[model samples]
Target: MTVPVVYSACEAYPTVRFVIATQPVASSLFVNPPQNLTVVGVDVKQRYKGTHGIWRLMGDLRREYAIDAFIDLHDVIRTHIMGVYCRMHGIPMSRIDKGRSEKRELTRETGKNLHPLISTRQRYFDAFKRMGFDFGETFTSVYPTGADTTLFADITKPKSGGERWIAIAPFAKHEGKIYPPGLMSLVVDTLSQRAGTRLFLFGGGGYERDILEEWACEHPHNVTSLAGKRYGFAKELALLSHCDVMLSMDSANMHLASLVELPVVSVWGATHPYCGFTGWHQNPANEVQTDLPCRPCSVFGNKPCQRGDYACLRGIDYHAIVQRLDNVINQR
Candidate 1:
């Protein structure tokens, strides 16, 4: 999520020469970053304690590049350590305002009136504003050039008279966010029956692979499974970009699809987009969610259902979602 936001800043302000300090995992996420952006991988596992973080940067990049200011957007205890290093080095710095108070109101159990909070992307821009940079542009995802179409093989793009390609990513990190598998099977079955429609199932893990494989075998020619293929991100991202529409849980796929500007029919379970985690430039109108009183019980959908039954998710009508997808597909 934060990846695109930082990319936008670097893209919008090409003259700034933004040096992005992040965990080592980021090295995999932002492959072939733009000219102005330089990602410095910090050993997050080390906790940046003792002689790590700002101290390390101060000794190396600071001496070489003549460093000026610091902006710690994470604002976590770990990043705070970097801020301390900035102060000791006499470099000016600012941290992003996470909009904690607004988020609190959106997620609170009692006396809650739900409304959209400040977007995480906007907050990143606001962080830049504090550093005397005003970025008025919207967020966009960056992908490798000439994204291979061959990896998709028989799953072609939607032609004027050809198949409408659909990617179904029906898993989230937690059970709270996942739509019922039986219900998702119905979505696959209905869509697969349509003339010139190809359904591709996307997910990871052996268990997810088994599930997708079973569905693919059941449907035969129309359904193909992309799970557990280990195609690597560069290939998967290109393949994802080829899709016409992505039916997904409110997980990474929503944001991943947004990068390619592919429209998403995201099913919300325990987490609401109102908490400011919606994908870059994704329309809220396309979102599929019921307005249950206990809609957003957890920010990340990792919490156990306080109601025990998880009415927030089980109560959602899958048929309604299918109808909505029909509408979205026609518009596309």
Candidate 2:
């Protein structure tokens, strides 16, 4: 989600050399960043273990990169410690206003204030503005010319003239956000039956690979499973740019597709778009979710369903999801 925002910042302040520190797992997404941007993969849990470790990490970053002012996008404890280090050194700093109270109101069980809050991307832009940096949204696609399509040539073939390519990311980190497998299989079955329609299933892990493989086997000619293929995010982005639409949960895949300006048909379960985690430049009309009062019970969809039935997800008609995809594909 922060990928495009940081990229925009880099473009806005061309004179400033921006250094981004993120988890190692996410570093792959920063492969071909702007010239002014440098990404450093930080193993926070392994290397920066304690307050002292974070303090030391700050010093290392400062000395190594000639640090000046600090803009803390993540206001977690580690970033708080980093702010302290900067203040102690007389380095100016600013942090994001996470809108904690507003988010609480949006997610609370009773009297929920469900209007959309400020977007996470907007919050990031505001943070930079508070630090006296000015910029507009100049980002378009990571692969301006388009991603190197040759990377996955083995599995993906050139799109035919009438082919409607669709990508489906059926898994999220939490169970609350996942569409029921039996229903998802029905979706795959229905979509693959259409003439000149190609379905690509995206995921990772052996369990996900097993499921995707089974689905691909069911629709041998139309469905291709990319799970556990070991192709990095760059390659995935390459493939995504060619797709007409992506079907995903409230997960990273939605944002990844957004980076390339691909339309997304996102499924929301325990988490709602009102939490301000919607994909960058995505249309709210394309979001497939039910209007249950207990919707958005968790901010990240990590919490167990309070009602023990996950009615918020189950109540959503799979046919509505298919229709949403149809609209997106036909419109394109």
Candidate 3:
């Protein structure tokens, strides 16, 4: 999500060097970045372990790059600690305004303010603007021509002109955001029956891999599972760039597909797009969600359903999702 904003910043200020520090796992997403942008992976778990490690990281950044200013996209305790280091050094800094109060009211159990809020992407852009930088939206597909996927020959074959490729990322970090497995399987079965349509399942973790593999086995001819393949972000994004459309929850995969300018048919439950996490330039017509007063109970979909039934997700018709995907893919 932040990837696009950073890309725009780099493009807007070509003469200024922009170094992006992010998690090691996410560094690969910065494929074909602008020459002015340098992405560095910080291994917070291993190299930057705790408070002391964060302090060391600050020292290293100043010593190595002579950073002119610090911007905190993620305003957690770790980032705050880094801010402290910048303050001590008399370096200018800014942090993203997350609109926590607005988010809380939007997700309150009752009397929810359901209007759309500033998007996370916009927040990132605003953070840069506060630091006296200006830019318009300058991001497009990460793969301008097409991604080179020659290394993935075993899992993927050459794309045929008649084939319609669809990528499905069925898992989310939270149960509230996930569709029911049985119903999702129904959707899979229905789509598998379509002519000239191939499905690729994307996910991670042992349990998710098992489920994806099972679906692939069930639809042996049309479906392929890429879960647990350990392809990493760069290769996965390459594969996704070739896909006509992606079906995913409001998870990292949705954002990943968006980075490649692939349209996503996103499903929402406990999380609402009004909370401003929608994929960049995705059509709202493709969002499959149920309308309920108790909706958007959590910002990240991490909270358990207060109604205990999760009617927001359960009430959604699987056929609606299938219809939306067909509309997007066939129109393309």
lDDT (C-alpha, whole model) for all candidates:
0.78, 0.90, 0.90
Candidates 1 and 2: which is better by TM-score? 2
What would the TM-scores of all predictions be? 0.88, 0.96, 0.98
| Residue 269's lDDT in candidate 3 | 92
Give the per-residue Cα lDDT of candidate 3 at 161. Answer: 85
Per-residue CA lDDT of model 2 for 166-281, tens digit only, reads 99999999999999888898899999999999999999978999999999999999999999997888888888999999999999999999989999999999999989999989
Q: For candidate 1, lDDT tens digit of each residue in 73-168?
A: 889876787788778878889898988877677777887768887888788778878988776655454554545567545444433356788889
Give the poorly placed runs of model 2, Cα more than 4 Å off: none
Model 2 root-mean-square deviation: 1.4
Better of 1 and 2 by lDDT: 2
Expressed as tens digits, the lDDT of each residue in 1-332 for candidate 3 is: 88888988888898999888888877887988999988889989877889998998888888888899999999999999999999999999999999999999999998988899999989998999999998988888788788876845667887788999999998899999998888899999999998899999998969999999999999999999998988777778888898999999989888999888999999999999999999987889889999899989999999989999889888989989999998998888
> Candidate 3, which segments miss by more than 4 Å at Cα?
none
What's every prediction's RMSD, in angstroms? Answer: 2.9, 1.4, 1.1
